[model samples]
Target: MADLESGEGKTPVIDIPEAVGVFDTFEDLQQAFYDLRMIGIHHSDISLLANEKVLKEKLGKAYWRASDLEDDPRAPRAHFVSEEATGELEGAIAGGFFFVGSYIAMAAMLTPASTLAASIAAIAIGGSPSAVIGILLARRVGKHHKDYYTNQIEHGGILLWVRLRDKEREEMAVKIMEGHSGRDVHVHSWSK
Candidate 1:
């Protein structure tokens, strides 16, 4: 509970509901959130930071405003540029999860049902067996490929700093980093 009463010789007292202590300051909190994002934990930190009601109230305005600007076609292209930067950040993180999780599942055959699903989708859509097989095989191969890519990014994929038009472009950058650059994906904004 928050300290409700305290003075000279008296101790603080509280009858309020308990509080969850996380970060003690907004700067520290944002730094932690950014650190997680930088390290491929994309979707993990926002809620934890948002739990700080005061900090959220302050930064939430900026976050929401930025998002709103992204939605406005007539807004300055710089706003959209910021969106791309944000997307690159997200892609780096989520790409890590996607590549790792999908690979693990495929490698373990955790969902032979996915093969069945692919077959059904292929059949219903009149896709060739080769196409379905390729899709499944890609899933299997993509796991190891992505794990390597994520490791590279974690180590020092610095070019991911280049701005792209959208999230897909950022994802493509991950592919490029692994295949061609011999480095981790890097997408640091100028602000970084």
Candidate 2:
């Protein structure tokens, strides 16, 4: 664990990719947490922070303190694919849906069924594949985000941040923080 304090009353710099939001009061911090939860992110994935002294004194042994000497083998690891990989995955999913849906719809057209029935059947069958793909994607993305956030927490003290699972969620998190007058709102990338 590196020293979390650069100077008195200042927050330490983080090296990993992360989204950070700073609040003036604990109330504001709680509100940000509430808003994030309302937007579908859970409380477990968020971290709250105060100044260095406050955090060190209040959290005491409860806080995660890292040494600058060597990597902590006990530190949590992020196992999910990177955000860039997820983007590529989403593209592949879209292409697959397009190709598979078109083929299924065309094949259904050849059957001796009414136009409406064939269209409905095609849509219903096509949705199955989409649902399956969507589920797998969501699970992997969610796990990755959660694990990365956990790793961040274990590496340093709580810093009032959120782990973004997608672009829309990232945007919404920034908006919510800025809307609440959060300062130093930054997005950083973490590498393992």
Candidate 3:
């Protein structure tokens, strides 16, 4: 299938580096996953999907996985990814907006405090169960934000991308991707 897809309008591209530079290491990536309660996705499906060989041979692996609920070891549709095609997963997590934590926040709410003193007590002892409750309440306001944004990004149907700050470098990368497989690689930027 042609990677360069278009219908009524042009699709926007996103840069990877600018998206992930907020983090310096994989540990930071792990924290984001933990905060979002998304570590499990990474540990299970995402990890298996990221194998390098798997990515190249079965670029649509995850899409296929979503088509069926049951596993069939011998199924012909199985995406047999190899070991060498691993993408820099750390990059994807860093560049992509992690949203599960935000989802949790939106779904949960706080009960009003019966008295100001209890609320004050909760604030004074941060990390106390009461304080934890307060944090959860705060999260209720911001929780839906992350999940919403992440969904939009993923809805773009792009798993990995590169962000080039320099125009020349950006063109070079696009040219390279075009040369490689005519895969219709795209360049992304914050400016939109």
Candidate 4:
């Protein structure tokens, strides 16, 4: 039951019904999330499937479909990270690379024997590759975070879970999910 009724608050939260689904695309996942919010679903009640790394760490390197984890309450869930956090991470990665490159170049050139032109040349030589590598790595990070939903779809499907307060919200959630191209949209009798 919802935490709405103040007097009957003694009702135990033993089992909670949850709507689950698999989204095939990022747009569908996003639209579903928005629609859920419009329907008064609290953000706390929504969760996404864990990322590839977490899955790997927990389940080992064995190949597994996302479907396998959908109904399992023990399956790990990913905490949502906003676009701002991802952007900051990308900036840090790139900046760290540049800093390391400059430091190493200075370490090699800060000597009386090194001319200004030689020092500058060393910096360019060392820094150029580092900058390129940084860009590539940063791009990789963006792909892992920004495109997470679609990437999960490629692996199997992007799993979404919405805790349902009642039959009405359950129906609404399933409808919104399916309308956005979700498959196997249904409500489990209990949730984690």
Candidate lDDT scores, in order, read: 0.34, 0.56, 0.31, 0.79
Winning candidate number (lDDT): 4
Compare candidates 2 and 4 on TM-score and give the better one: 4
Ranking by lDDT: 4, 2, 1, 3
TM-score of 4: 0.63
Of 1 and 2, the candidate ranking higher by TM-score: 2
Cα RMSD of all models vs. native, in order, equals 19.1, 13.3, 16.6, 7.2
3 against 4, candidate with superior TM-score:
4
69-119 in candidate 4: lDDT tens per residue? 787665668755546667888888888898888888898798888998999
TM-score of each: 0.18, 0.37, 0.22, 0.63
Clashes of each: 9, 7, 11, 0
Candidate 3, residue 101: Cα displacement in angstroms equals 24
Q: lDDT by residue for model 2 over 102-136, one digit each (tens)?
A: 67776777778649877778867775676576657
Model 1 per-residue lDDT tens digits across residues 85-186: 444554555455555555554544544556766655544443344345545555555454435334323422211222333455455434543444222234
* lDDT: worst 10-residue window of model 2: 66-75
Candidates sorted by TM-score, best first: 4, 2, 3, 1
Leading candidate by TM-score = 4
Pairs clashing in candidate 1?
103-143, 152-184, 153-184, 157-184, 160-186, 160-187, 161-186, 161-187, 161-188
Q: For model 4, what is the error of residue 68's alpha carbon versus the real structure, in angstroms, after optimal superposition?
A: 1.6
How well is each residue in 1-192 modelled by candidate 3, as lDDT tens digits? 112223324434333221111122233323333432221222221111133234335343444331231111111221212112223332333223233333333233233533566545434442344334544554543444334333423433212223345666556544543443322345333311
Q: Any runs in candidate 2 off by more than 4 Å, and if so which?
A: 1-17, 50-158
Model 2 gets an lDDT of: 0.56
- Which TM-score value belongs to model 2? 0.37
